[model samples]
Target: MRHTGADARTTLQKGFHEPVEKPKRFYKTVETTPVDGGFGVLLDGRNLRTPGGVRLVLPTAALAEEIAGEWRAQGETIEMADMHATRLANTATGAVPNSREATAGQVMDYAASDLLLYFAEEPQALVERQTEQWGAVLLRAEEEARLSFVRAAGIIHQRQPEESLERVRQIALGLDDFGLAGLAFGAALFGSSILAIAVQRSWITAEQAFELSRLDEAFQQEQWGVDAEAAERTDRLRSEAAALERWFKALRT
Candidate 1:
């Protein structure tokens, strides 16, 4: 038996085959309230807290209403997967407070070995495609990120300049907790911090970034026929990237 992308996402959503205990929906109404700094969601008359027990105060009333809408949409059983906005807010409030620096470091590590920096040594067609598509993105990175990355022909380890890494680190560090979480998620999903940054800055749409990141994989799938599992993975990746793009936009506004 082969594990699938859906299987992995299921595991991520519902821990390791854990029993799904359906909590009875107790709240009659979901609403938003103005807090000190921002707004928060209220169920009935009680304020909603994150899984970490902190008051779920969002920076914007719009975002708070969005999260409240998620709660309102739930029926008898709350589908956690459907509440991506709430989950992202929870991460921004809970996890990111303690792990901001570490998370930024992890994203910087990805920049060091970014997928865009590696080119395939192959037939002329594939090489040309990489140069045309990936090359444009690299140039965008150089211009936007203000750093010149070292590209390599093959998998041989080539060290990126320290100045380039520092520039990326500076950009990552400048993002707020919500933006940081989205960037980390997007970078990991697409395997390119450049694409993730471009999407974050609205230079390109999530679909464009996903397509560019999977250029080689798509080429292979077209030539050799697509595997069911591989196609499923691509769908899941696109969905996640779209979600991240939405979250980033909401967070910025």
Candidate 2:
């Protein structure tokens, strides 16, 4: 007899005999080749295309190989979410090309509420941790981007200097579409334009940038027990950070 949806799930959870759906193996092999301007990926001997149906021609051969490697690493079921490198390349090649200015503007907008600009209050330890970890990154931004960011002692809102904002905007405008995409990812992941710029400039590695971003949360987690939901969110952010790091490394090669 057939069971209801919940009943079937309960039965499966109870370890009753049931057939499990196996993952589908879509492609047998993946390869890469040099295209006219960049490189493309071939899945089972046919060139792969983006979701938008455009031929996936990445700007660098290294990037192409990274994307191809993602495809080749797929298990029986091809999970698009697992293909972070390919998705990032698709954004760089397709999305960013048509919206470079907008993307740069988005990254620049993060400067308004950049994580480094906000500070914790009360506890001296947390405050000092923020100062020690985030302050150095801010100094690096001032030196590298020539943009001086104002800091707040607490949650009070503060307006950054107009000239500083414009200077930061100009720096963002200077980056190419590929660079802008990576910067946007890094900035959004860490919620700090300064950390993102530092990552782009090699002032700090992605792992260090993440650790800096989560300093306050890490402090609180140590004081209190960890929350499963918060841990999951941190894991996802770390994964995104690593993906952006790989993309940037590919661009450098």
Candidate 3:
């Protein structure tokens, strides 16, 4: 009988599967308060947006600028025509996008999130990539959902619709919690999409996402000699993200 070491290890590794819970980290839930009878970002009882109504959450300057740049190059607001999964502000549910490119705010939000998170976790030297991506649009369209929530909230406060059906669109704290869980579980294998949504939606910190990504990359690199730990971690994180997406999907279904 010939036995390979790999087979033995595989069998042994499966034996360690225990009924344990995963730890949740990288979040600091402040609080929520009502603004004009709607939800507002809060730190305990204080309103995040006050006086002028700008969000109190830390803004990612590079992100906001990149989206603005795209608009400048295009001569007007822009949006993807074939954005299948990219749910824009009103496009997702069949409403005009503020008489603009029809539905680009969310796209900008998605792209901005990409810039913010990349710069956030990235070293200062390599953080200038947004300048190059200004005229380019290369991101998963589905991620625009994050921006939808942010914009929806702003619009909610502004319009104060009699019905306010848009409230149904709000992503709950649980989704944020789930996204964070998935990121930590990946421990570096976390996808940019998840992190992008988080920051754009103002859930987790960009610094945390960047740091986790670096650690995950480092962990995987260390295993290159004999194993693909990074790949393994990524696979697991993918599963988690899929689960979070599923939860959200189920609600819509």
Clashes of each: 0, 1, 2
Question: Mind giving the per-residue lDDT tens digits that candidate 3 earns over 141-236?
Answer: 224442321111111122222221122123322233223222222222233333434543444444444433344244335556425664564444
| Tens digit per residue, CA lDDT, model 2, 1-253 | 1111122223223522355554576788889998887788999988888778888877788988989888888887776666788877777777988887788776677777677788888599999888888888888788767889788876667788877767767777787767777887777777777778888888888888888878877888999979997787677667777887888888888
Q: For model 3, what is the alpha-carbon lDDT of residue 100?
A: 26
The residue-by-residue lDDT of candidate 1 on 183-250, one tens digit each, is 87677767777777888889888888888877778878778999887777677667777777777777
How does model 2 score by TM-score?
0.87
Measured by lDDT, the strongest candidate is 1
Best by TM-score: 2
TM-score for all predictions? 0.86, 0.87, 0.25
Q: Model 1 off-target regions past 4 Å? A: 1-26
lDDT of 1: 0.78
Off by over 4 Å in 3: 1-227
Ranking by lDDT: 1, 2, 3
Local accuracy by lDDT, each model: 0.78, 0.76, 0.31
